[model samples]
Target chain A: GAGVSQSPSNKVTEKGKDVELRCDPISGHTALYWYRQSLGQGLEFLIYFQGNSAPDKSGLPSDRFSAERTGGSVSTLTIQRTQQEDSAVYLCASSANRGRVLHFGNGTRLTVT
Target chain B: AQRVTQPEKLLSVFKGAPVELKCNYSYSGSPELFWYVQYSRQRLQLLLRHISRESIKGFTADLNKGETSFHLKKPFAQEEDSAMYYCALSDTGANSKLTFGKGITLSVRP
Candidate 1:
């Protein structure tokens, strides 16, 4: 089975620019999640989506960070006005259902130059 | 609020030596604990979950609600066990959100 897929394995953006990272969860997966992995910071939860329920955006660092999972499948994480601190690997994961084991994608490495 | 803590940033052990990776968490309600591992150049994957009480790759973790801890242990560490390990907690049920720790790197030397 195809695992979770993320696009743009490497992305370099200028400060103040905006970048959108895409994620395609596995088929039949009802739960999708986004996380940021940085040196020393570890893996930080960014957002989560489960079926048709309202997504959890609590972990989003700022208003500039937002995500949308359209049609309950693909998700896009957009960071407006990117900053140096935003340089990190963005990971996407999907699970069969809530609280299930997650399958992760290769992730997109975003470097703010 | 939910938080997972891996106090040690790194752990290095010799082959055949016992290994223990400590993890502690704080949650208001019943928590679902999990251990995720990432080998070099590989994506993060589930190593084990507390609920299953199963061992994977000779590693086992016992969830101690009394101590609020879930520590991963192995009787004899192997070089292949070197990897990054993360302890996580699920915050919600229907819309479960995982809270991950800073993660700890385990290095097994021959």
Candidate 2:
């Protein structure tokens, strides 16, 4: 793809429901990142995947949040038992390499009602 | 811990006027700073990085290590420049995950 692509641009789920967001990064990109943007808040780092190394999951808010990247290309972010506070935009970005410019996707807006 | 701060949530400026967006950061190690912008209905994109020392769309940001600041400036603001701007920092090491500041909204009025 010419740019990073995210699926299900909008998702509204009831509280306690699980939601999954997907990202397809640009071809040949070696680094990928996930972030959360609450209403009127800054981007919060969630996780980072660099090659085959263990993902940097330091920023995951809780055990309910998890992510996996398959074949070093597509990634998925799963939020379990979502809470109302989880309502936010989930953004995905990919870069050619670590410390390089990041290309972002339109993001998936998750509304936990 | 690396942190970035954008003090103003909203700024208003007339078209053709100069504009400056303030940003401050704290990091123990050498930092790599960057500016990112998001226009309406657009994805977030890089505006500039301290390492490149280049200007995009007439906007420039100079890293002041002593002050721990990297402020974005433009000689003349344009209506098209109205958008949300974010300041971000990353550690100079291999772990380049970025830490972003609360974004500032720029409103360029005609």
Candidate 3:
């Protein structure tokens, strides 16, 4: 079976520019989540979507960060203005639902130069 | 708010020695604990969960509500087990959010 897939694998963006990261979850997985991994901070939950009911954006660091999942499968996370601090590995995961083990993608490393 | 902590940043063990990775969490309600492993150049995946009560890859974790810990343990470690491990806590009773620890890098020697 195909696992979660993320695009580009790596991205380099100039500071103050906007960037979009894409994620394609495994088929039949109802829940999708976005996470970021950085040195010292470990991994932080960014947002979560489950069958398009209503996205949980509580973990978004600021207003500049946003994500949308279309057709309940593919998701994209956008940063309006990138910063050096945002340079980290952006990971996406999917699961049958909450309380289940999440299957994660290899992640897209974004570097804000 | 729930938080997971892995105090040790790195741990080293011999190939035939026992290994224990510490994990602790603080949550208001009953929470579900999980251990996730990430081998080099591999995707992060679940190693085990408290509810399942099953061992995965020779690793096991016992949840202790009194100590507020769910440390992962293995009787004998292999060099392949060397990787970054994270402790996560899910507040299943309330809002569904997974809080993760900082993670610990384990190195196994032959």
Candidate 4:
């Protein structure tokens, strides 16, 4: 891809429903990251993935939030039983080398009603 | 735990005036600091990093480990400089994920 791309730029869903967000990192980039920005938390780290190794899931708010990167190319973040608090701009970024610099996508605006 | 703190939520300055955005961090060991800027309706991009020690768009940031701060300074503020700025830190590791601050919004008035 030319740059980092995220799917479903904007999504509105009813509470308690499930939603999935997609992120397509830059080609040949190995490091990928997911972050959430809400009015309360400001910007919070959700997850981290590097190549094929195990992902750093330390930042996931709960078990309901899970992400997987397939073939080290694309990623999907699934939120089960969505809550209003989960509504925020979900940003995805990737770095070609390491975490030195990151290229960010336009971001997906998730709104839970 | 690693954390970046930008105490000021907002900063206001007139065009052609000197401007400074403060950023402080807390980490046990050495830290690599960076400054990122996001213009209105634009994706976030890196403005400068401490390691490179280079100036971009007349903005420079020095890593002052003594105070654990990386303050971004520009001699003359431009209207285009009005944007959201974030302070981030990363450690020396393969994963090297960034821990970002709450971010500060800079408004430059003409």
Candidate 5:
């Protein structure tokens, strides 16, 4: 892909429902990251994947938030039993390598009603 | 804990005026700082980094370790420079994950 791609640009789900956001990182990129941006807030780091190593999940806000990256290319973020506080933009980014510049996607705006 | 802090939430300046967006961070080890900008309806993009010490689109930032700050500055602001700016910090290691601050909104008015 020319740039990072995120699916379901906008999602409206009821509370307690499950939602999944997908990200397709730039081709051959070795690092991927997930972030959340609430209204009037900064980007919150959720998770990171580098090559084949264990993912850093320290940033996940709660047990309901989880993510998986398959084959180090595509990634999915799943939110179970979503709450009203989950209504925000979920952003995905990728860098050529660690410590390099990040390229971000448009992001998925989830609205928990 | 590694953290970035952007104090001002909304900043409005006339075009051609000098502009500065304040940022501060707290980290125990060496820090890698960057400024990311998001224009209206556009994806967030890298504006500059303290490590590169390079200016992009007339913007520059210098890391002040003593003050624990990395402020973004421009000699003369332009209307095109109006955007949401974020300050980020990376820990010292191969798996350098970024921690971002609450962004500041810069509105360069004509």
Candidate 6:
């Protein structure tokens, strides 16, 4: 079976530009999450979506960061006015409803120059 | 707020030697602990969870509520075990969003 899939394996952009990272969760997985992986910073939770209810944006570092999951399957994390501080590997994960295990994608590495 | 801590950044050991990766966490309520591993060029994957109490790839972790620790251990190390390990915590609530620690790198030399 296919695991979580993320697009644009690597992206380099100039500061102040907007970037959108996409994620395709495995079929039937209802929960989707985005995380930022930085050197020495570990995996920082960005946002989470569970079913159709309100999304958990508590982990978003700032208002510049936002994400939306359409049809409860595909998700896109959008960063407005990217900053060098935002450079990191963005990871997407999914799990079944109430399932404890999280299947992760290879992640998209974003670098702001 | 819940927090996971992997105090050490790196550990190096020879093959066949015992390995222990330390992990400690802090949370207000009862939390679930998990160990995630990432091999070179591979995506992160679940290695084990405390609730399962099952060993995978010769690795096992025991959750100690009194100490707030869920350290991963292996009796004998293998060169193939070299990779990054992350400790994560999930609250018992419905959300189950995980809080991960700064991962530690294990280098198992042949």
Best-matching candidate per DockQ: 5
Model 3 agreement with the true structure over B22-105: per-residue lDDT tens digits: 999999898999999999999999999999999999999999999999999999999999999999999885238678999999
TM-score per candidate, chains pooled? 0.97, 0.98, 0.97, 0.97, 0.97, 0.98
Docking class of 6: medium
Q: Judged by lDDT against the true structure, how good is candidate 1?
A: 0.93
The lDDT of each candidate is 0.93, 0.93, 0.92, 0.90, 0.93, 0.93
TM-score of chain B of each: 0.97, 0.98, 0.97, 0.97, 0.97, 0.98
* Candidate 4: regions farther than 4 A off: none
Clashing pairs in 4: none
lDDT of 2 by residue, B65-102 (tens): 99999999999999999999999998878878989999
- Shift in Å, residue B110, candidate 4: 0.5
Pairs that clash in candidate 6: none
lDDT of 1 by residue, B1-110 (tens): 88899999999999999999999999989898999999999999999998899989999999899999999999999999999999999855667788899999999999
DockQ values of all predictions: 0.73, 0.78, 0.71, 0.69, 0.79, 0.73
Q: What is the lDDT of residue B35 in candidate 1?
A: 97
Residue B17 error for model 6, in Å?
1.0
Lowest lDDT sum, 10 consecutive residues, model 6 chain A, at: A48-57
The residue-by-residue lDDT of candidate 6 on A1-113, one tens digit each, is: 88899999999999999999999999999998899999999999988899655457899999999889889889999999999999999999998965378999999999999
List the candidate 6 regions with Cα displacement exceeding 4 Å: none
Error of 5 at A79 (Å): 0.4
Report i-RMS for every model. Answer: 1.4, 1.2, 1.7, 1.4, 1.3, 1.5
Which window of ten consecutive residues has the lowest lDDT sum in model 1 chain B? B90-99
Error of 6 at A2 (Å): 1.3
Model 2, range A21-110, lDDT digits (tens) per residue? 999999999899999998678999999999745358899999999999989999999999999999999999998989668899999999
